[model samples]
Target: MDAASWDERYRGAELVWTAGPNRFVEEELAGLPVGRAVDLGAGEGRNALWLAERGWEVDAVDFSAVALDKAGRLAAERGVGLLRTVCADLTGWSAPEAPYDLALIAYLHLPWPQMAQVLRRAASAVRPGGTLLLVGHDAANLEHGHGGPQDPRVLYTAEQIAELWRPYADVLRAEAVTRPVTDADGSHAAVVVLVRAVRK
Candidate 1:
């Protein structure tokens, strides 16, 4: 969807996503020391706000201006002065040359080539020994996952993630992870591709 579409989606709602951060984000980054971080495709400031509160100086980038506005407000309200909200296309936006302590690309579902381009850029932004975390809808999610984009072409796999990060970072874990989805009837599984790497 385009920025206008996203803006429309967010304009009506006070919050497009949950107020809390993503579970995977906290799980992976909680113990890490504070430093400069970038949250690419940062929507509604969940992860970026969380990072700022935890003492990380965060650059929150997203194409949606409306979302960025919401993010800025959330930051101010949360007493987090460590965040900078930027509105830009992650695929084309040239990152500042300074390396970051962490680069986070969560749920940015583009076609394969575009996704690779953005992922490479995100990885390059990370300083040596810094962490790069990517989370996306697993290709297998078409069959098993819930609450994700429906297009399979935009979905990704662990192998694709490993291949993308192998040259520049040490691949710690690249795999299809399962999440439990609870419903009125019962609980089921959902798949998501999670890639955690540390720049070499």
Candidate 2:
């Protein structure tokens, strides 16, 4: 979907995504010391706000201005002041002025080539010894996982993520990690593939 579509989607009565941060983000970033961070495609600023609460200065970038506005309100309500929201297309958006201590690209789906370019740019924005983390729907998610984008072209594998960031950063961790998803029927299933790498 384009920016207009996403804007329209977020202009509705409710937030499309949950208020909390992504589970992978919480787990992966829990141990890191707070520093400069960038959240690409930060829908509603969940992860970005969470990071801010933890003392990180966060830049939350998304295409939807309405989403950013809601994110700002959410941040104010939560009493976290470290969030800076930017409305721009990730495909053409410029990187932050300074090198970030951490860069997060969570669940931002795009075509394969564009995804690679975005990942590469995100990785390059990280400072040396910093981290560039990516979490998204696994390619297998469409067939086996519970919820995410249905399009296979935007879904990714651990190998693909590794290759995308290889030129700019060292692969610290690149594998498919699963998390449980609870259903209304009381059954449980796994969803999402988490890929994490640190800048060399």
- The numbered model that scores best in lDDT is 1
Q: Pick the candidate with the highest TM-score.
A: 1
Root-mean-square deviation of each candidate, in angstroms? 1.3, 1.5
lDDT of 2 by residue, 79-184 (tens): 9889999998999877867899999999899999998888888988899999988888888877787777888888889889988788778887887767677768
Name every residue pair that clashes in candidate 2: none
Q: What is the number of residue pairs that collide in model 1?
A: 0
Candidate 1 overall Cα lDDT vs. reference? 0.91
Clashes of each: 0, 0
Model 1 per-residue lDDT tens digits across residues 1-200: 98999999999999988899888889999999999999999989999999999999999999999999999999999899999999998779777988999999888999999889988998888999999998878999998768788998898898898899999999999989887878786887789889999999
Provide TM-scores for the models.
Answer: 0.96, 0.94
- Give me the runs in candidate 2 sitting further than 4 Å from their true place: 183-190
